[model samples]
Target: MKILVTGANGYLGQGIVEELSQKSNVEVIATGRKVDRINVDVKKIPVDLFEVKDPYNYFGRPDVLLHLAWRDGFIHNSPAHIDDLPKHYSFLKK
Candidate 1:
């Protein structure tokens, strides 16, 4: 299956991608706000989630998406400032 993994440049994200990539018949698409400096075999992409209406559209019809991103910090980190988690998740669930 084609897996679109967000925050794939982060520590946890990178690890997941690395481990999953070695398995046969699995395609890993890694995306983050910024690219990882280190070299890796997985597909890498840079995207800002907030700017996207439907974030998954960027993946070109992914079969699955491993959500590894959360908007955090004092800058913008609350339900009041962002979309409802359940609703946002539901949107992606489609």
Candidate 2:
């Protein structure tokens, strides 16, 4: 099964990817805004969820997508986070 995980570089995401990747039947496709910096042993795709046109174009067609990504300072609803809301909606529409 192909599994796509967004925010794959974050604290919880890293652990989730590690655990999921250990499954023999799972194919992990890890994505993050700074995926290049993520130190995971899996297929990594760097994507700014707020700027992508067609996510599938970059992420390929996966069997499932676990949306865990959030803009920086999301907890406090910073400017970037606020601006990302529309982008998030657009991505979801696609």
Candidate 3:
């Protein structure tokens, strides 16, 4: 099974990637703004969720897409947080 995980460099994302790596049947595609943070033996693609014009073209269609990447992470009620809403919608619509 092919799984595409966004924000693969984040705290929870890192753990998720590590756990998924142990599965023999899974092929992971780890994506984030910075690719160097991911040390797993998986396909790494640098993707800033809000900036990607065509996500499908960059990463292709995966069996499962784990959308964990977020802008202004963990910062509630901030301007950056508000800015993320539209981006999220755009991501889903695309």
Candidate 4:
């Protein structure tokens, strides 16, 4: 099965992608703003999720999508989180 994982370069994302990539039946598609930081041996795509028109097709029509991408996650009251709400919604809508 093909699985598309966004935020694949982040701390949690990296571990998830690494674990998923080890599965023999799983085809992992790792996506992030900086995919070079991802250490897993899988398909890597550098993408700005907020700007992608069609995420499903853009990331290669995967059977599943694990949307872990977020900005300013450590900042509890970051304005970026609020600013990106609409973008995140739009990305998920498609």
Candidate 5:
């Protein structure tokens, strides 16, 4: 099964990608704004998730999409979260 993970360079994302990479039946595609931090051996794609029109097709038509990408997640009141809401919604809508 093909699985595409967004924000794959984040703390949680890195751990998830590492675990998924060990699965023999799983094909992991790691994507993020910066993928250099991901230590796992997998197909890493550095992209702006908000700009993706068709995520499934854009990321090789993965069977599953793990949307972990977010900005200023640690800041409870970060304006970026609300600012990017539309982009996130639009990306998911497609």
Candidate 6:
């Protein structure tokens, strides 16, 4: 499965990128606000979720989208748990 990982340079995303890189079953497409990262085993794409047309803009359809972004008083660990604005979630559905 192809996975699009948002906030992939953060704590959870760091581990996710490394773990997925070692696996042959999934392709990890890593994106973050700042592109300052390096893990050659996986393909890295720099995307600032805040500035995009949508958070999922550059990314095409993915088998799974592991959202890891937040707004306002939101915290880490569960960006998906919070109710993101319609424009954001709608992007993923596309």
lDDT of each: 0.72, 0.80, 0.82, 0.89, 0.90, 0.68
* lDDT tens readout by residue for model 4, 4-85: 9988898889999999989999999999888987887999999798778788888778999898888877678999889999
How much does candidate 1 score in TM-score? 0.71
RMSD of each: 3.9, 2.1, 1.6, 1.0, 1.0, 4.3
Instruction: Give the TM-score of each candidate.
Output: 0.71, 0.80, 0.86, 0.93, 0.94, 0.66
lDDT of 5 by residue, 1-94 (tens): 9999988999889999999999999999999899999887899999998777778789998988888888987788999989988888887777
Cα lDDT tens digits for candidate 2, 1-94: 8888989888777888989988999899999877754565789988677677777766777788888887673467578777877777788778
Highest lDDT scorer: 5
Model 3 Cα lDDT, one tens digit per residue, 1-94: 8888988898878889888988999999998898687778889888677777877666777788888887667776668767777888898676
Candidate 2: segments with Cα more than 4 A from true spot: 73-81
Off by over 4 Å in 3: none
Q: By lDDT, is 3 or 4 better?
A: 4
> In candidate 4, how many clashes are counted?
0
Better structure of 1 and 5 per TM-score? 5
Best by TM-score: 5
Candidate 5 residue runs with Cα over 4 Å from true position: none
Candidate order by lDDT, decreasing, is 5, 4, 3, 2, 1, 6
Cα distance off (Å), candidate 1, residue 8:
0.8
Candidate 1 lDDT over 15-86, as tens digits, reads 888888888888888887876742568788787765566666767778888887655523464763365465
**Ten residues in sequence with the least summed lDDT for candidate 5:** 49-58
lDDT of 5 at 60: 90
Q: Please identify which of the two predictions, 1 or 4, would achieve the higher lDDT against the true structure.
A: 4
